[model samples]
Target: MSFQQNLQSKLQGHLSQIDGRFANVKLLDQFETNTKLPRSYAVIGFVGFYLLLTFLNIGGIGQLLSNIAGFVIPGYLSLKALNTATKDDDEDLLIYWVVFAVLNIVEFWSKTILYWVPFYWLIKTGFLLYLSLPQFGGAKFIYYSFLKPVTDKHLFHESKPASKVN
Candidate 1:
């Protein structure tokens, strides 16, 4: 298949998945019922909302919304993960929370300076999303690549061999 056809096929599959998710949502059901458009169009509405909050002359409101969203979406996901019978999902959530804690610590110290950079909140919110989203596998990658190594070295050292000669 040509690249364009491949891309279009992948996008169609993704849209169908998103539509299915929205169709299951009780709140969005009301909106979907009234429209001929598929429920996935709600994603476009959210994207517009996000862009308005992000780029408009809204002062600190954008930053506030970004922070709230960055927290709330993953917070809800973490709650869902906790309530599930399988504990397997907890590992990613735990790593995500750990990284969030480390992020906040650094942000607490550096925020004043960070805001001077363009779109600091937007960047931070995107980073948090990247860290939390399972599809990205970012939290797992970071934990194993960086955080786990340090902890294992300092906190979980191998037992020393018997010191005395046999």
Candidate 2:
């Protein structure tokens, strides 16, 4: 067999495996069937969960919840976007997740400075809420207004087209 034939066979096998794995997953159906109620509940539940974590402040549990809120929530949302084949949604979630991850890294490096600020965790919790809640589009706005401009300038260097006078 030629190299091209072998490559085609491998590609077909990989695609079949992917199809088999996703055959049982019905994320899109679930999302379409009950959108509003689940989304609202998710937003409320996350808010309550964060509040509980903040108020309780138990030693290890607080840390665990913090990790879950910071990592797992966004990660799951991003994967859901991919699973549903929503390119725009996937991009938005990924951008938000990347920005949050970078901010967390910065916070780690500036722990001493942040520690002096009162209600730091509260502020962070609020920011996470803004990012995670799809009802607000806060993350999308922030990305386009702030991150996109900077990234566009540095990465693509594409100048904006001039506006024509009517």
What is the Cα-based TM-score of model 1?
Answer: 0.77
TM-score of model number 2: 0.56
Quote each prediction's TM-score: 0.77, 0.56
In order, candidate lDDTs are: 0.78, 0.67
Best by TM-score: 1
What tens digits encode model 1's per-residue C-alpha lDDT throughout 1-166? 9999999999989989988766668767777778866777877788778867765528677678667766887798889998999877887888888877877887888877565878776676677678878889787888899988988999787556743434
lDDT of predicted model 1 = 0.78
Model 1 alpha-carbon miss at residue 94, Å: 1.1
CA RMSD (A), model 1 = 4.3
